[model samples]
Target chain A: MNQNYSTVAQRSSSVLATNKVLRNTYLLLSLTLLFSGLTAGLSMFLNMPPMTYLISVISGMVIAMFVLPRFANSTAGIGIVFLITGLLGFGLGPMLTMYASLPNGGNIITLSLGGTGVIFMGLSAYALATRKDFSFLGGFLMVGFLLVLIAALANIFLQIPAMSLAISSVVILIMSGFILYDTSRIIHGGETNYVLATIGLYMTIFNIFISLLQILGIMGNDD
Target chain B: MDWMQIASALALGMFLIILFPAALQMMKNSPKAAPSDWKAVIVPMIIIVLFIMLLIKLV
Candidate 1:
């Protein structure tokens, strides 16, 4: 009886821990999204030059990869999350403006935003409800990500619109896989830190949104 | 070339440098997958593709 009781207690505690992480991650993600949106709006209002985006985004990635992880365990991580996300959003400002300039730009943006929301919600719900281990995707997705990055970098010189569309489509698939992997990790206790979890999800959503925009823009021929 | 093109190439190149080695290491360490795993990934992807196609058609 004691052995059985101990097992039950351990499982219960694991479940509780998972719940806490999942709850905190979603809460932080929502707040950060709102924060980023505001910064993007400010950037758009200022009409920052196009180059502002590339520089800010590169800086954000560098910080997120190198600096944020160090502070991820402390309260300072929250502030850093905001800083990184704000920089990314601000970078998006000029891109959004360019899209909005297209004849059907407004519609394209709205549709992309909606599509991203739907995909994220759908995938998250599936992973949470099923509680499957998607850790297996890590290798495959990482390899695909590298391959796509190589393609994208090469295409910078090529500058082919069709290739851009292909890259965007592949990116969407990769991001979708990440959503499932990240959500599953939260449920299975693979990820314990809500801060890191929040960053992972936020970046996935950010990638999905941007990829959708590129895909939609190309499909709409807003060149 | 325009400044924007130069900036993009530089940024993308840096991103590749930062992400490449890490990704390769992760891939090296990741576990081998079962068929069910691939199915899990593929089904959802197909749905996503169809959903995207629908969205494109709507556009």
Candidate 2:
């Protein structure tokens, strides 16, 4: 399959790269996921309002953009990652609560979670094994990413269900592209810091789950 | 428009504005993909689409 990756001399730098960062990224990612889930459960138990979701997510985004990068190389970065994840997960509680009120909501949530797991694992494995550079995805994903952001922002006021469904479907594909790009970056040394890398991968998984949940939930409602 | 909706639209707009330049720079600096490279990504993406469709049907 990946001939260059198979042989010793021709092996892509990815296979030869220090896999310690990769291993650590996964470890930290799992820990953050558990922390986030715990916080989400706590938020739901407290009956957090929908606004809390909006507020916390906005706060988390601000922190991620302005603060996390400065400290991403330090141990403090780990704390920041947990803080951001917990905040976002806390935000997620109300959304999940809303979904849970629907018929067959549990199935929708479970399947979205499971589907996220399968897609992340499958894409990550492929990226790792193939040893192909996905750097070219940079420009394409950027255009797609920006266009989708504009569409999503417009849809907020439009409140069109079909448009929302289309957005969610496109989001699934975009996040998948990100997974490949991010994973390949890690392998090829384009991404070295485990903290930053974990955050990238974590966000992709989170988005995939959210988009999947929305898509499946909408489909169920149509039944 | 409601205050909340206006606030949301502003927030999303600001997020895009903040991120755009850096995203564009990164895109410009990265290497271009070969025609052959597209082959690898398209195959899995198709499989993913089909798998998602199946999940929708099964559910």
Candidate 3:
């Protein structure tokens, strides 16, 4: 009886912990989205470019992300959020401008958001229900991602539309795998911290959303 | 389709990829009731913030 009770207690505690992490992550994610949208609007109002400078900024931001995890527990995390928000805001300037300038700008945003929503709902469900170990995908996805990056950089100078579209498609696929992998990690006891899980899941969602937007832009002329 | 959107997405995507693992590692290694010190989040955050500011200003 004592042993059974201990097991029950352990299970309940873990469930409670998972619930807490999921709740916090969702709250923070929403807050980040709100801030991102606001910054995007502000940048558009300030007449920021939709390209060039954003590329450089993003490059810098990527590099910073590498460095930030080393300081995850400090007040520095706040600074990291500020930086991410700023970059995200700047990044949105172009979309914001396009949306405001084009007749179908709102459509583009809506479609992108909707597409992201669908992917998240579908992939997350799969992750939760499926029994396959997605961690095996980490290596393959990394290789594919590297190739995509190289291809993307090469295209900047080569100026190939087809190549860009192809890269975007692959990115969408790769990021989806990441979502499955990350979520499964959490479910399988591979990831125990909600903060970290949130970051992983957030990245997966962010990429998936952006890639969907790219695909929509390439295939649909509604915007 | 536009260059800016591509660049922005790429930048955000890459940063999160790097941070996600680090955040996980931090959590995994941390002890209960004494979350490990996260001094590592500074460099990337500051770098990213500066970049974002610059992007906003220059773009």
Maximum-DockQ candidate: 1
DockQ of each: 0.74, 0.67, 0.06
Candidate 1, residues A162-220, lDDT tens digits: the string is 89899999999999999999999899998999989998999999999999998888888
Candidate 2 chain A, poorest ten consecutive residues by summed lDDT: A9-18
Q: TM-score of chain B, candidate 3?
A: 0.45
Worst 10 residues of 3 chain A by lDDT: A56-65
> Which digits, one per residue and each the tens of the lDDT, describe model 2 over residues A73-157?
8889999999999998998999889888888888888889899999999999999889788988877887788888899899988
Q: Candidate 1 or 2, higher lDDT?
A: 1
Task: Give every prediction's interface RMSD.
Answer: 1.2, 1.3, 13.5
TM-score pick, better of 2 and 3: 2
Q: Rate the local accuracy (lDDT) of all candidates.
A: 0.90, 0.87, 0.60
* Model with the higher DockQ, candidate 2 or 3: 2
The candidate that wins on TM-score is 1
lDDT of 3 by residue, A1-223 (tens): 9999999999998877766656665666666667767776677778876463466356435634565566556656645655665566567677657654555546656766666666666667766666444565555556666667667766766788788777876776677767776776776667765545655665666666666556555555532
Off by over 4 Å in 2: A1-17
The local lDDT score (0 to 100) that residue B27 gets in candidate 3 is 46
